[model samples]
Target: MKHRKLISLAIVPILVATFIATTATLSLAGSSINPRLYGSDRYETSTAIANQFSNQTVSNVVLASGNDFPDALSASVLAHELSAPILLVDRNTQTSKAALDYIQAHLRPQGTVYITGGTSVIGSNFESLLSNQGHQIKRLGGSDLYDTNELIVNELNSTSDTVYIASGQNFPDALAISSFASQTNSPILLTQTNGLPKGAQEYLTNNEPKNIYIAGGTAVVSGSVENEIKSISPNSKITRFAGQTRFDTASLAYSQLAANPKTIYIASGLNYPDALSGTILAALNGDPILLIDPSTPLVPDSIAMYLAQLYKNGATPNVTALGGSVVVPDEVINNVVNLLNGQSQSPLFNITTVDSRLNFGGLPVNLLPNKTIGSTLTLTNTTIPIAVFIRR
Candidate 1:
């Protein structure tokens, strides 16, 4: 009995090793990439993102209205500065339970919660709720959305010579530069397409940032606005990042921010909530966030083209999709995987294992025959520990 047990113990490791080797070989056939989905809803997604940093103690939390984008557009930089998570709350609700719970659990004892936008946008009741919990609350709202953005920038007390200007009328331009802005500790100021907002004008006139980067094309941010910015900060070096579409604009922004990233994040371009919270997480890793049209089944052309060049240069970035399938569907993610594999369609197909009795490390494993295994196999929780072989 002792001899038999020793032989079984030896065999188990060999089987495990063999299984891992086989699967590793199959995984290497294509880019070892997969999309990790964050949450089921926007509110839940923010908590999920916050949980990513659970290992560390968060000192502050930024609360913004999920109903609008303008107030939260400039919150990323502030969140990065505070080493906090940007949590989205419903303006109608007195409090967001998920956000509150996360704050209670992670925030330091004396930590303060920052609220963007006025009481009209987030309400006095929400502030009262946090104050009741013995948490210090600081409101950074102004007379208007632009003012709120400027207030957030002022709160940063950033002396960095670089600043970013995006269209306040839309979310794409602002969201595109969010991660980069947060990473660099640069304030992202919002402006109108034809004219600069008073808040932004005052900031430019006073600070005169040496480097100004304008996101979006001339149509989104008119030449007049650019010239106005130049005139306000004449000594500042100005650069504009624009593309044919919002998706293209995101690609261009990311390409300029990171040369060869090992990880890339995707969020729906149609909405701002996912990207808003996601920017903090991406910024923490110095990664870029690419916007995708969730309505489309395939990846955006510009994103695909940009990723293709990265793959050509031997980059296999791990792609993560923020939000649920409703916002960023499985089809779009599959297309990205296929693109990385240099295939127009999925190279995966169901393959029946020839040996069902195979076991590795006392766990059941499905062993594929050498002749039938494909180039890649996507495994889920229910179907892992699979070993594939190529028929010689």
Candidate 2:
């Protein structure tokens, strides 16, 4: 008791807890991640935002470094990429000499469908394709207007039901972007996949977007991009498409777009568009496009559900024994078929939407909840050929 004044006190636990709490709070507030840097200063500005809010580092960025951010008119163009008007041709139909013959046959007076767009060389080549096709589509933009506010009052009036085709990088100078939010007073910079122009920036000053795809490719984000348009828009409609290396397969990408569609989003090759698995799946939207090739199990949710529902009585294929990079269980393969046809097998039993939990100890732990079968798609043809477009 004489040494009470000199007691060592056990406040260590409290201090440790305080420190951890502080650290966690700060991390939750915001932590930056380095993405593969690409494009001009405006693009760099967008990269800086990614660094501030993300938690990953990019060792290698793919797209070339160039200043592609839009000016006023260009910003108007970016705003235009809200909802895409995609016209998909079936692979079977596409391969038919008749299909190519049809497209070549339908090449309008100057008919060329621009498939992609960003803030770089996509402009000239884009114009050429459309022009060569006999169409005269001109970008109505100036410079530095990623938000489409400028285009709202001025542009939309001119484009009525006009399919503004853009591919391989676009976002015309943001006089104002107008592809979406036709009724928003000043055209609330509505980009489900990317950021809006300046006005959208002002509108989204304190809000998040419906969806924001932060890729380091041609569709790179612009300067202070998030702050510029996140608030002006809505998060429920926003979709951020980051953590991608490139757009490889037609099948994978189609799934993504179906999950979240957009007019202005990042893609792998703008010049050479890939075949979309969705195109085929669309054919069977109301029917079943079964992938019964025991060699390759059907994974697309739409297709899987169709298969599951088609075989409520268990007539689905036996693809659990296929040899590939995957090792699927038998019941799962069968269940997938049942679920696909709109039949109700425990909704929780959807192996197609669950994680392949593998634990080192006892049984694997599933860390996520179940998912709902949203939509259906069909693949009329399994095999598709790559079609290359030559801009004359």
Candidate 3:
């Protein structure tokens, strides 16, 4: 009996180990590769993002104006909700050649393709062209940007306590936060800097979203407009996230809105094409997109600081540069890579006048905020984790 019990115990351990190995394999199968989806231009870039899900079967797809901003800003929520990708189509060309080819190759024989905006923005024949290709078409748009925004919001099956608001005149703020908005199912509404857009006002009047997050500072969205928002929903709380520049604002958004993003997409702040497509890809991967200028000599200060802080906290995030060399450039990529590899540039000068400080009797520095200075202070570890390197 003792011999049999010993044999059973050995067999049980082997069985448990085999089960764990099998479970791990199954879990890993669901997680896929993180690819930098891009193309020659905006049209192709959007196609590349859609191709990421090509292997899987989807019943629907969403189309938005490639040349404009307002329609696409409000389309992300519906796109995410429907498990659809937002493809950019030229208003005059109807659909770009690259997009049509991608659809024919990757997303054919699907149930429907919902196109946003009316015929004026997308051309009247665009719908018919898709219909002729055997793709069932549904168009969503209104007479103006405000009306279209309202129309888009109404399509949502439900709403959350939070909503995101950005200027309709531009695309940066909206693109930067699209992934977070989609993930949280928060509706993004467009507003003028000085006042609220009609669609935004209408949506607030109809549905109550208690928490509203405003992207960009007063320059992009003015104080008067903020007051109007307060008047609309007096009880609702408002939060603003902005920085010295658009790139800073994007980094701030990623830092505050996302929780330890495992991956981040770096795109040009000067252009819209790369980021427009990149946003959808980032959202799909459950990541955030940080903006940077490819033309700059070094990574912008705010972005570098944010990345340094992230690295200091023990995060090894996957960094992807969107667009080709022309859009993001090699120097920018090198700077970001060096940061991730912990090969940051050395400081300009450290303790230049150490003897001078000794001769003058160095004073105890109180770096701690809001602390009253005292005669004696304890000094812990003296090493600073981060140092700023300045170029002369």
Best by lDDT: 1
- Which stretches in model 3 have alpha-carbon errors above 4 Å? 1-35, 93-95, 108-110, 345-392
Query: What are the TM-scores, per candidate, against the unseen true structure?
Result: 0.78, 0.27, 0.75
lDDT of 3: 0.67
Badly placed stretches (over 4 Å) of model 2 are: 1-103, 110-133, 139-199, 202-337, 342-392
The sequence of per-residue lDDT tens digits that candidate 3 reaches over residues 1-392 is 21111111111111111110000011111123243567877888777777764546666778788777777777887888787777788875544887667666656584578777877777868677778878888778898886787787878875578889998888888878888887777888888879898778877877768889899989999999889988998888888888888878877887787546666677877766667666666776557777776545367777777777766666666667677655665445556655655557322112221111111124633222233333343434443222211111
The models' CA-based lDDT, in order, is: 0.76, 0.27, 0.67
Error of 2 at 356 (Å): 22
TM-score of 2: 0.27
Each candidate structure's count of clashing pairs:
1, 86, 0
Per residue, candidate 2 scores C-alpha lDDT tens digits across 1-392 of 21111111112111111000000111101212111122222233223222322224221111111223222212322222322112212223222232223234333453334322233323344444335655545343333333223443244333322111111133321101121222121232323234444444443443333343332222444434544433444443433333232322222223343322211111112211111111111212211112222222234444344343334433322221111112332333433433433444322212222224322224452323232211232334333221111111
Q: Report the CA-based lDDT of candidate 1 relative to the real structure.
A: 0.76
- Model 1 TM-score is 0.78
